[model samples]
Target: MGQLPTDVPWDVNWDKKFESQLEELKQSGSFDTYRKKTIRIIRNPIREGSYKSENLKGLKTAHVSGNYQDIICFELTPGVNHQSQQEKLEEVYLHFIDHWDNYDSALSSRNAAGRTVEFTIEMPYLEEGYDVERAKNTVYKAVKDLDGSRITQEWGDECLRLTGEVSPEDKDVVKTAIPTTVDVKFNENTLF
Candidate 1:
């Protein structure tokens, strides 16, 4: 996994805010409440196929989409290892949206310090009805073929199971562990 940029494009200094909120959340026991806004799942291409003769001799060209979402995350602390945090957030986020919204996948991470997570969440151009789940199936095969393994195989498999495509006998899984609360008595102004 690559590193998410520390210099995010937003007005808020999310890093500082996250640290402050994390402290408060630790005290209050409602950590999930610290999440700023709804995390969005953006698609990133995992791989593509070529029409070349040697590589395509016995194979046909194909396009593959990844199962993982590009999360636009807002956090309450810096202690969360960036990559792991993004991945974990995606895990819980996918389940939450699958149950609550028409969400497919997401790529979430914190913005710059002062910018509100709302700025990105409120992007006017953010189109809904995106086929994130479909993209996941496409990407899974592509990613598996590219590196001989899937980047988010576990997540993909779990999603399939949750949607009833796989059997419990196939794998041991836990898909509903997302935090549900935060420390502060958050009002609109508090933002967490």
Candidate 2:
């Protein structure tokens, strides 16, 4: 699980591109609106919608702004050992900002590097004599072996829930790596 800080101030990394876009916004006639939106994002960036904020489909990146025309793109960096709730995760990297006219191209370029694929799999139903810890260990080991993957596990009423991200190209490998007996289901829309 990813943990977000409740009282701690989040650190923001202004990329070169974002910095320049911000300057342009500052000089524009709509500077006040853009500035307020940027401040709101810096103060609490995880909120989505209404302000044209959304998590980019199939990726760990997101964007938010006062209007559709001027958008700020950012990437989330989950903290180590944080509890698994996605909303609670901390750390944001502001990497890009551009007009709606150039949004698609900017998104495409960033995704070309690598897209994040999120998955949810249920642990297999264990027999009475089977060791639950060992079963979990197997799943954890499989995910750990992946090149770029992070997962959070939770025990539910009837099954164990595993959710996390991995490189798009490694999706198939991850599926095969899970224990054969485990019954898993992937969220189709989340697969890159």
Candidate 3:
């Protein structure tokens, strides 16, 4: 089995499909954004609630990206050395940077290596006059009831932004729970 170095300059093993997807990102003008996000993730893979990083529930994998347009998914495997009694961890694999539109299908058909699927929802900027904390808690509870993970509540543009991962079937439950006046929007990754 492979072992990851514990110190600086951590190991990162990229999957075979990553190269082609990277080249495509470059051609499409998202390379710069993707590069920055990737670097941030590599520097601190374990950080939680980051706007640029998220933990996918079902797949047992984490992804780093900006605007949710392009995603770089990876899995961290833990290992223990019995003889030396030392704990070790490795970012066993870095999957391809999948586009949002194809992410679901690719994730469904591809080999998850025992990882499951998770549906992420982003609700950005609630309308004025709504209690931000109350609204966030309500949505958070709704998602939690459905077994969601990586729930985050933050303030953006002076308004509340909530993001979390849930099962595909439970997406409607959370959506319906939000008040119509809030203008909840999903991250479709379309610039137009």
- Tens-digit lDDT track for model 2 on 86-113? 4554443333434433433433332212
lDDT agreement of model 3 with the native? 0.43
Give me the candidate number with maximum lDDT: 2
Shift of residue 31 alpha carbon in model 2, Å: 28
Which order, best to worst by lDDT? 2, 3, 1
lDDT per prediction? 0.25, 0.47, 0.43
Q: Which segments of candidate 3 are over 4 A away from where they belong?
A: 1-129, 187-192
- Superposed on all Cα atoms, model 3 deviates from the true structure by an RMSD in Å of 15.3
- Cα RMSD to the true fold for all candidates: 21.8, 16.1, 15.3
- Name model 2 segments beyond 4 Å from true: 1-54, 57-113, 124-130, 145-147, 188-192
Q: Model 2: which residue pairs collide?
A: 1-83, 1-84, 2-83, 2-84, 4-88
Pick the winner on lDDT between candidates 1 and 2.
2
**TM-score of each model, in listed order:** 0.19, 0.41, 0.34
Q: Which candidate is the best by TM-score?
A: 2
Cα misplacement distance, residue 25 of candidate 2 (Å): 24
Ranking by TM-score: 2, 3, 1
